[model samples]
Target: MSKKPTLRDVSRVTGLSMWTVSRALGDLSGVSSDTRETVRQAAAELGYVPNRVAQELRKNTRRSVAVITASTSNYYYINMMKGIQRTLRPTGRTAVVADIAAEGVYTRELEDATVQDLIQSRAAGVIATLTLSLDSVELLEKWDIPVVFVDSDPPAEAAMVPAITMDNFAASVEVGAHLAGHGYRDWLFLAYPSRWSTRADRERGIRHASERFQANLEVIESENDVESAYATLSAHLDHGSLPRAIVAANNPMVHGALRVLHERSFAVPDQVALIGYDDFDWAPLLNPALTVLDQDSEDIGVQAAQILTRIIEDQIQSERNGRPPRPAYQPADRRRVEPRLIVRRSCGC
Candidate 1:
């Protein structure tokens, strides 16, 4: 087979200097439109593909932002990614996901390794879905790689870092209040592990609401995936009677609870009612439409991306000005989005 074409081949074919070819291909300011088009047509004819790794190595900058997350199977990440990608598109940057919990489990070691990998690649910025360890946060900060948390908070020690999260406590309170409105005296909460920062607040709100409404509340923890959710809830149900209502903490938990109920031939909102966090496309399509607290995950993702982009740009400008390129995080960088409960058949609405 023939060897792959390179920039030198494009320069040779276009009868232009390598610098001009590089500028035209990169769409930098120096190249005129006519010459840029000529270089592009010749490169296309020659099947020349720019080597991004080499380009980054030469420029000493990264063009991709890393998104740190766990539980890649969760549907919430899908819309969140859509928002991140859409926001990054016009900026000429890309988003790369690094799933620390690819096996449906999260470990400190995995988180460390993922952060190390991002640092090695010189990621421009990070948007994390789980609170990273303080060590990881400090390491990224040391490298001048800013992190913006989305749907999660930064480690408490790193308070100045930016974050965009929904008011999970209030959201959970609404969930509990809605269930209480249906007079669901015995309530079950299917929750993901507290490794996710939002879990504590969500559980706190649920507990407060349960006390306020005088409901009997049971909280069960599961790994952040559908299968684990199914197994955990199934085992719980095997030992006890179903509660009057179930509140699933997120998409995976919701799926798991629904699967267990369906397999057992349980009629939703009849003998038992169900509600979930994070609305998705198929939530309304289910036989008994799922009532959910819509966190507007996409908007959160957009805000997180925008925040990271601004920080990265600021760092770049600082570097250009011959200053230390540290992330300039302000108190106002911490933001919260409100969640709205969508009533549907599943919640006995």
Candidate 2:
């Protein structure tokens, strides 16, 4: 087996002293531009890659932010990730997704392990899609790794943590009101479990709107995936007649409801009106099209990334100033994005 090239190999190839080669490779000011270019070319020819682990050990920081998510298959997450990556690109940092619930299930043990891994890697920061456990939050805090929540909330114990989320309660209320306008008095809400903090507010808003509009509402919970949503709704429909309208809580739930309706030969808006929480690219291309509350998930991601970046920068500055590198969150950092309803054929419009 061939041995890997080292800094010394680049020095030997460039005929430069180790100190000069180190300065050139590090992009430090002591090396002239011409010398730096020569060293870089030599290093490139030697196939020498800097050991990031060693660099991180020396710097006590990381250039990659970890996005903690559970359901990567959801379309909303795809757009959100686009926003995060786009925003982080100019900052010279990268985003890495850590799926604690890769199997479509969230467990305390998995959350703990993910946090432990991030701590071990010296992650720069975190952007979470669901509320993390108190222990995980504190552990990240202790390590000076800031967290920014996107489309989710921080645990109550960590109220000061930054979060960028939509006004889910108001958005769900709008969805309910639109259904009421369509005379959908009997409504069924297919929701993911409350592990996602948005679920409670969304349900509350739906319930409030239902009572105000004199509608009867039922809420059913499912695991955070299409298959679970499909099975949950399928089982629900086996015993009761279809409601006047169905509200799907998110992308996967929308898919599940649509699948159940199609398999049961139920015509949308003719027998069962439908609405969903998040809008996706293909929403308009569906047979009946989809009426949805569009929550600018990409913008939410951008905002979360911006907030995390700012906090990380502050921590870096604090460390340079010989202070503890705790994340400095501001009241304004807990921001909410407004959601708008996108009307389409699915809701009898």
Candidate 3:
């Protein structure tokens, strides 16, 4: 059996010194850009692959950042990717997405990573969107990689991982207040239970305002998809119990709840009002139009990327300054981007 060619083969084939080959392939500043391209082409021609681990040990630049998101089906996540791309494109950093799809009949979106997978990806840094198991977090910590959490809060111990998220609690509060302004006191918050910080924050915001409005607010836990929402609401409808107003956590739930109400011949904003979080483009097209919390999707991505980039730059600087690459600061500093309330007929506002 023939063994694979090495960087030495690339150097010989490209008529470059081993040191020049190494510097070119490593994308170091000392090598001319054209020389780097020529060496890369020669390596490809000779089927010579550089050893990433070997190069990492010798301090090479990382070409990619890892992004683990709960699902790609959600438009919010799709929009968030747009944000990430906007930030990463010009900087030459590309994202490798790990989207964990939900199994059937599940609502709370979560992701768990096997250590082998994490080790194999060799991601220089990680950006996670939803809830990752404590074990996964611990594993990443042990690997000593930078992490930036988005749309979810990091634990107290992970203070170095800066978080970018919508103001869930505040958004909920705004929704509840808006519903109250429309003269509805009985409200139901359709949600999914998750360890993810967004759930708890949203609950905090909604509950606080619900109390302030002196309204009877209840939580309706449902699976992440539309079918689960239909089932949950159907069960409630069977008992002839319905809140005067409903605030769904995301777009799918809003549509699902609306479907059930329509099936039962309930007049929207009259028999019941509807509001939701994470505004969708289709919201205004709904018969009565949905009132919602407008999350700044692109902005969220840009800010997160910028923060992570700054962190990485600082780490590189610290290395130059004789400091070891530190784990992102402890006790992640959370930045809560505000969600704008888009009032429409759904809330009778």
Give the TM-score of each candidate.
0.83, 0.83, 0.75
Clashes of each: 0, 0, 11
Predicted candidate 2 versus true structure: per-residue lDDT over 1-349, tens digit per residue? 7999987798788888765775567654456789899998888888998766644442655588999998787888899999999999998999999998875789999899999898768789999999998889988886678998888889888889998888888888898889999877999999998988999999999999999999999999999999999999999999988899999999999998899999999999899999998889999999899999998898888889899989988977875774557789899999988898999999999
**Tens-digit lDDT string for candidate 1 (142-183):** 667899998888888897999888888888888888888887
Q: Please give the range of 10 consecutive residues that has the lowest summed lDDT in model 3.
A: 103-112
Order the candidates by lDDT, highest first — what do you get?
1, 2, 3
Tell me how candidate 1 scores on lDDT: 0.88
In candidate 1, position 44 carries an lDDT of: 93
Candidate with the larger TM-score of 2 and 3: 2
What are the lDDT figures for the candidates, one per model? 0.88, 0.88, 0.74
Q: Write the per-residue lDDT of candidate 3 for residues 1-349, one digit (tens) a residue.
A: 7889987688778888765786678765457788899999998888888876656643735456777765455567777778888898887888777766453232323344433365445565778776566567766665456677888877776555678777787778878878888889898888865644688888888899989999998887876667778888888778858789988887667867988999989998888988887766677898898888888777787877777776767766765664545555634456878789988898876
RMSD of 1: 10.4
Candidate 1's error at 77, in angstroms?
A: 0.7
Model 2: residues with Cα > 4 Å off, grouped in runs: 1-61
Q: What are the runs in model 3 whose C-alpha is more than 4 Å off?
A: 1-60, 104-110, 315-323, 327-333
Model 3's alpha-carbon lDDT is 0.74
Span of 10 residues, lowest total lDDT, candidate 1: 53-62
